[model samples]
Target: MLHGKVVLVTGAASGIGAAAARLFASYGARLALLDRDEEVAALAAELPDAVALPYDVADRDAVFAAVEQAAARFGRLDGAFNNAGIEGLGGGMAPTEGYPADEFERVLAVNVRGVFNCLAAELPRLPPGGAVVNTASVLGWLGGPGQAAYAASKHAVVGLTRSAALEQAARGVRVNAILPGAVATPMLLERGFRANPDFAEAAPGAHPMGRIARPEEVAEGAAWLLSDKASFVTGHTLAIDGGLSAR
Candidate 1:
């Protein structure tokens, strides 16, 4: 559905962001893949008509520069997937009272402030029909044990998505958020699982689908939201969680 449109995907080096980049490319979209990881450059090299923008989303000036550079490279930006985020300090599983204040600040800076920075830079450059999708989490809806910082940041992301959607709806720009369940990504496997030994075993059963999601599954929802197919959809929180939230 994207066909020749230019889309900016943050966290494009891996996980859902990487999956989205490949999927969007398959749909004939030109890509601007942004990530702090240099691996993004390698991914961009593998795609046709793609540019790698290596920058950290937490850096406001850098994000603005990257967005401007992407638009300049592609001539116009048709859509975006604001997907870059960190779980929290050391897998982020900590009691709220004990959750280090610095860690909480760090998470907010990256997850909430980072998305804000991207939106601030991207919205003005988008045309009437341009779309944006922010990556929230299923935790944004439900609380988790020892997940205050991560949950709080995702909740903020949901608020940002809805508010931005309302602000831009009249201009024909769509903004939405995706709340994903446990996905088989490094963020979960290497970090989260390591922090909570039982997580890997219990995660599948937590979902009615009886399995954790693949990054591509979450990316699929984002792809449609960013495409013309969902033109009327805005301020919506899409749960790509295999029925986890149904409980």
Candidate 2:
């Protein structure tokens, strides 16, 4: 489990991040919960020894400071869940010539650059045996009609994980990425997929498992990666996509 260890999780206010934070806490991790939402404070208060940090992951300095503070409080940095990301505005493939440049950039900033910022700050602080897990998406491997930007950002995250894992292997810091499929979370609800008449049939049908994933299910893979049980694992992207990518 994660007894006595300190784990920092970004996007800890909701969805998979929140689930992972709670799960880690249940396993006795001293949690540092980071999210842009001020509500993270209340959520953290429920845990035995958790600190909620409200900051924008897009801001490199702020992220660095947050990681430093977490390490200082816990006396060591053992693990981190770099799960902060944005879905971006869904856009159709309009001949590829008229894609919205700004929208694409914004998605990259949060999903790709955000991961980089956190890693840049956290890697130096992590002691030997430290582990880091990042959230990518099944779309990173597969393609989506109107999800080009989001998919590309996730693909970049996977690449970052592989490269960072190799670079940090000598230090005993394992880095891995999680590729989650259509998880039932607030983000999915906000996208209105659940309410759509066709969603019920089309969504689950996409995955070979015949169902969308729950956030907690994805968190399970994350927990394993961040634990000593996966000490030999690094630079790998574990797909928790209900066989979506396999199809």
Clash totals for all candidate models:
0, 0
Which residue pairs clash in candidate 2?
none
Q: What are the per-residue Cα lDDT tens digits for candidate 1 across 20-124?
A: 999999989999999999999999999999999999999999999999999889889999999999999768478999999999999999999999999999999
Candidate 1 steric clashes: 0
Please write out the lDDT profile of model 2 over residues 148-189, one tens digit for every residue: 788889989999999999999999999999999888887776
User: Which is the leading candidate under lDDT?
Assistant: 1
- The TM-score, computed over Cα atoms with residue i paired to residue i, of candidate 2 is 0.95
CA lDDT, every prediction?
Answer: 0.94, 0.88
